[model samples]
Target: MKMDCIRTTAAGLAVTLALCSPLVAQTATETDNDRLDNAWSDIIEGEGQLLSPTQYAALNNLAFQAAAARVCDGEKLDSEAFGKAVADILVDTETELTDNEHMQRNAAVLISFGTRYGLFVAEANGDNEKDFCAVATKLKAEPGKVPLFLK
Candidate 1:
């Protein structure tokens, strides 16, 4: 997590979130359940190429969530730094993005990240922590599908 990029991403996210999506904004037609369903649906849509704006947004958030979760679970290897690293992967500002040249990507990350974080915290119906730790242990073991952050 470079300081310069963090600053740039913060500014970009602030502007985008402020102008495009209000954190508390809700339509009369859409309920909280609807939004959650939409978020989950967006995640399902992410299984493909993940070209849709909704999927992109959801993935960004899932990045933040996964990074933060590993860090919070006391499996501290290098995952502590990864929460900030999500911004770097959020948008390749260095490259000429013809497909996503116009819109700000950091804002989508912030919005989706916050939403998923909330959802993760609100989940109390199951032993998610135990399940998450089991997966973390496997990733940390041989096979090693997950590289950095879960060690």
Candidate 2:
């Protein structure tokens, strides 16, 4: 009876460990950078065709710079640098936008990016979303407002 009880406890422990091992390993091994980088790279590759040549080039440049910045920020060897790179992409898209609608959309994208990763020190410090929307709305109301608003 004693031997059977010990065996049953051992079996239960083994099963529990087996079930939890993968989860533990995943949590211990995986970092936020890995997920961020993967998502950003996928977005750039999949959506590159949608952008104009100028926009694509600007975004690519920003992405490259942001990657270097993230490497400096991330402490680990496999740290993912996607989040900041995506923010840079949004900034590039914002800069490339000629129309009010596109600017507003890009601003919203930037705001979302900032909200997600706390990017763009200046914009994140200020009320970037509200400023962007206000500028966009003003530009829509008066086309002449575009230059001033951007300025």
Candidate 3:
């Protein structure tokens, strides 16, 4: 009788672990995504003060890939258009980013990220150009809906 009880407890524990493992992994992924999203928002909104170069690089890479995945199709990435779109979404006319060099740097970051992410997602999704373009267009039109799209 004691052996049977032990076996049942072990079985229950195994079942619990099996069921919870995937949820834990999913939760971790969601948390990471949220962190990345927040970082991107900060940078775009000009709150990325005193961030190390490595941190900026990571954030830039993540943002670029995510944005590219949302916005670019299989065609050549139009960096200028992407920069303008991002500027429209994140920058206000009243902001003090008047220097051409600063604006250009931001634009370059966007283009680099977009290009990398676009190529990656395109290849990963079997190069479905039509779908890629459609999704990219939708994302560009509604940048605020990125979290929903990511999910």
lDDT (10s digit) by residue, model 1, range 89-110: 4664444655554254555555
lDDT of 3 at 11: 45
Top candidate on TM-score is 1
- Over 4 Å off in model 2, which ranges? 1-41, 45-50, 73-100, 108-151
Clashes of 3: 1
Model 2 earns a TM-score of: 0.25
TM-score of every model versus the real structure: 0.42, 0.25, 0.28
Model 1's TM-score against the true structure: 0.42
Q: How does residue 1 of candidate 1 score in lDDT?
A: 36
Better of 2 and 3 by TM-score: 3
Comparison by lDDT, 2 against 3, better one: 3
State in Å the error of residue 147, model 2: 25
CA lDDT scores, all candidates in order:
0.41, 0.35, 0.40
What is the Å distance of residue 60 in model 3 from its true position?
Answer: 6.5
lDDT of 2 by residue, 16-45 (tens): 223312221233244222233344333333
The TM-score, computed over Cα atoms with residue i paired to residue i, of candidate 3 is 0.28
User: Candidate 1, clashing residue pairs?
Assistant: none
Per residue, candidate 3 scores C-alpha lDDT tens digits across 41-103 of 333344222222333333333443354455454324455654554454334333466689567
